[model samples]
Target chain A: GIQVEQSPPDLILQEGANSTLRCNFSDSVNNLQWFHQNPWGQLINLFYIPSGTKQNGRLSATTVATERYSLLYISSSQTTDSGVYFCAVLGGTYKYIFGTGTRLKVLA
Target chain B: SQTIHQWPATLVQPVGSPLSLECTVEGTSNPNLYWYRQAAGRGLQLLFYSVGIGQISSEVPQNLSASRPQDRQFILSSKKLLLSDSGFYLCAWSEIAGSREQYFGPGTRLTVT
Candidate 1:
């Protein structure tokens, strides 16, 4: 089984600031995705990057499969961005291993 | 566009009670379905997944079981619930062919007392 670890277990930022979260896996992965869990407990899909970089609005992600790590960037953060961010990876099985998550708090 | 649905947005049950949560996906066929659990203030844990009708895989052993009787419907059931079973359950779906970008349902919060 592959292990997924996320750095900065907790993060707090003022609105309009920027932040980067990291995810490291112990093995090669076929699929990797970023998600933001809102206060209401809904997992919102942010990006699906297996081995490249992609941007969506104020957020972007990059995955280096060979290095077994991924980065998620948040630009111009907002108060609404307060929640937990999770990185999940699917290695050689149908299951997706999730990181411990980065709890983000964007203050007003 | 594909949409995944989960029923009983919230539930509260006593220990040893039976449990069943339903998830259905629309606007797609032969999609892969998955069930995940998230403890209070914790990350998501894969419980089960289905690649197709009647095909299921369990990621971890637990008091829970899943079934995919139909192509787009996945169900999580437990004959006896434990206090530790209280958590938020999420359902997700991904395409079978092109990519594995999983889309999740709103989720169901279960509290076993």
Candidate 2:
């Protein structure tokens, strides 16, 4: 089983601020996704990048599979962005392993 | 686009009670279904997963069982619930033997008092 580790377990930012979240996996991954679990607890998929970079609105993610790590960038953060961001990965095995998550708080 | 549906957005039950949570996926057939539990302020825990109807694999040893009666229907059940079972349960699906990007359904928040 592969282990996933996320950096900055907790983060606080002012509105319009920028931040970076990192995820490192212990093994190669065939699948990787970034999810934003809002205050209401719905896991909203942000990106499904196994490799390369993808951008959606103010958020962007890059996965360097060769390096076994991924980075999620949040720019111009809004109050609505306040919640937990999770990184989940499907390694060589079919199952997924999730990081503990990076809790973000945006102060307006 | 594929859509996943989970029932009973929230539930409160006493210890030792029976539990059943249902999940179904649409716009796709023979998808791989999964059941996950997320404790308060915690990450998702894989409880069980199914590749197809009548095929299930348990990830953790817990008081839970999952069944897939149809190509797109997955059910998570527990004969006797424990207080420890209280958590947010999520159901997700992906194409059969295909992609890894899973589509998740709104989770069920279970509280065992």
Candidate 3:
């Protein structure tokens, strides 16, 4: 089983601000995904970046597979972004391990 | 387009009661299905996964069990619920081709009194 750790367990930002979240895995992973669990408890897929970088609107993610780390960037944050951000990875099995998550609060 | 569904948006039951949660996927075949639990202010924990009909793999040894009687249906059951079983249960599915990205269902919020 691989270990997943997310940094900055909690974050608060003003509207239109920017922030970054990091995830570190203990070993090699064949799959990595970023998810946003909104206030309504719906887990929305953000990115499926096993490696390299990807962007969708004001959100972008970069995965350095060789370094066993990934970063998620949110620019011009909105109040709608207030929720939990999760990083999950699949390593050597069908099971996906998730980090404790980063809780974000964007104040309007 | 593939869509996952979960029923009983919320549930409240007494301790020792039997529990059953259902998940179904549409527009896909032979997809991989998974069950996860998220406790309050906590992370997601893998409970069970199925690659096909009648093929279930439990990640954690608990009172909970899962079954896949059909290709697109998954069921999570508990003979007797515990107070600790109160949490948000989610069902997810991914492609059978080994892709890691998974689409999650709306989730069910269960509370055991």
Candidate 4:
């Protein structure tokens, strides 16, 4: 079984600040995605970056498949961005391995 | 354009009680459906997945079972609920299979007492 781990389990950032979250997988992956679990428990897909870099608004993601790691960048953070960020990867099966997650708290 | 829906945004049930959660997808055909559970302060766990009607694959063995009576409908049920079942349940759908981005429903919060 492949293991997925997230770094900086807890994070606190001020409004308008910038932060980076990282996800590391123990094995190679064919599919990778970033998600945001809001306070209401809704998981919203953020990015589906199996490789390369992508930016959406003030948020961006980079997945280095060769390195088996992914990075999520949040710039000009807002209070609404406060939530748990999770990265999931699909290796060889239909099932996805989800990282422990990075809990973020943005202070207004 | 597609949408996923789940019923009973929140639920409180007693032990040994029956439980059923319904999930439906609109505007899509032959989409892959999945059920995931998230414990308090923990990551998401894959419970079950379905590729088509009457076809399901279980990832973790437990008291819970899933059924897909229609191409776009997935149901999670339990004859007897356990306290360990208290968590957030999310229903998701993907266009195809491996590596595709999954779109999730609003989610249902279950508390078994």
Candidate 5:
């Protein structure tokens, strides 16, 4: 099984601040995605990046597959961004393994 | 456009009770469907996945089972629920080929007492 680790288990940022969350996996992955679990417990897909960089609005993500690491960037954070961000990867298997997640709280 | 749906949004059951959760996908054919559980303060754990109709695979041995009777429908069932079964269950779908970016539904919150 591939081990997935996420850094900064907890983060608190002021509205308008920027933050970076990281995810590191133990093995090569064919698929990698970032998700946001909102306060109501709804899991929202943010980015699906196995490699290269992608941007969506004020959020962006970069995955260096060769290094087995991924980074999620949130710029101009808002109170609505407060929630748990998860990084999940699909290896050689059919299932996707998830990281422990990074809990983010943006203060208004 | 593709969308995944799961229901009921929330459930409460007693020990040894039966459980059934339904998931369906629209606007996509032959997509891969998956079921995952997110326990309290924990990450999402893959429970089952189906590549096609009647082709189901279980990731971990548990009290639950999954069945894909239709091309775009997936179901999770348990004859006897356990206390540990309580959690947020999510249904996701992905393309059969390239990218494999899974799109998740709103999820169902189940509490087994």
Candidate 6:
């Protein structure tokens, strides 16, 4: 069994601010992804960075396999980014174990 | 273009009642399907997954069951629901197995009363 831990379970940011979220896994992972669960409960895929770095718009993510951790960075945050951010790793048995999520509230 | 569909945005059922949730994918073939449940403000928990029709693997031992009648269709069923069954159910699909990014459906919210 693999365990995932997300730091700072709760977060609040102001518009135009910057923030970073971290995810640590207990074991090796073949796949990793970040998702944003909107207020409507829709799980929207954010990034699929198992290793290396990727950037989409004002968001970026990096995963270090050896370290067994990933970091998601948000720059110039917007109100639409206000939601629960989830980090999931595809580990043993090909199942994804999601983190508790970091609830982000961006105040305008 | 690929898309996942999950039905019945919301449901309220009684204990011991039968439960069925349907998920279908469009414009994709031989995709791996999975079922996950999430408690209020919590993480997603893997329920089951199928790589092909009539093939299923359960992760957690529970009252839940899953079936795939078509390459693009997946169904989750339960013979008897429990109060703990109340949660948000999400159906997801990926191109292949193990390590592929999953595309999730809108999700189904169920409340076992």
- Residue-level lDDT tens digits of model 1 in A1-108: 789999999999999999999999999889999999999999998998998899989999999999999999999999999999999998765678899999999999
Backbone clash count, each prediction separately: 0, 0, 0, 0, 0, 0
Error of 4 at A62 (Å): 0.7
Q: How good is the docking of model 2, by CAPRI class?
A: medium
RMSD of 2: 0.9
Instruction: Supply candidate 2's per-residue lDDT for A99.
Output: 97
- Chain B of candidate 1 versus the native chain B: what TM-score? 0.98
Docking quality tier of candidate 5?
Answer: high
What tens-digit string does per-residue lDDT give for candidate 5 at B1-113? 89889999999999999999999999999999999999988889999999999999998899999999999999999999999999999999998888888899999999999
Candidate 2 C-alpha lDDT tens digits along A11-82: 999999999999999988889999999999999999999999999989999999999999999999999999
In order, the candidates keep a fraction of the true contacts of 0.90, 0.68, 0.90, 0.81, 0.84, 0.87
As a whole number from 0 to 100, the lDDT of residue A2 in candidate 3 is 92
lDDT of 6 at B106: 98
Which residue segments of model 2 deviate by more than 4 Å? Answer: none
lDDT of each: 0.94, 0.93, 0.95, 0.94, 0.95, 0.93
Lowest-sum lDDT 10-residue window in model 2 chain B: B94-103
lDDT tens digits, residue span A1-108, model 6: 889999889999989999999999999988899999999999999999989999999999999999999999999999999999999988754578888899999999
Q: For candidate 6, give the lDDT of residue B65.
A: 95
On the 0 to 100 scale, the lDDT of residue A41 in model 5 is: 90
Clashing pairs in 4: none
- TM-score between model 5 and native: 0.97
DockQ of each: 0.88, 0.79, 0.89, 0.80, 0.85, 0.81
- The digit string of per-residue lDDT tens for model 4 on A12-82 reads 99999999999999999888999999998888999999999999999999999999899999999999999
Model 3 TM: 0.98
Best by DockQ: 3
Question: Which runs in model 1 stand beyond 4 Å of their true positions?
Answer: none
Report the lDDT tens digits of candidate 3 across residue range B11-108.
99999999999999999999999999999999999999999899999888999999999999999999999999999999999987857579999999
Please give the C-alpha DockQ score of model 3: 0.89
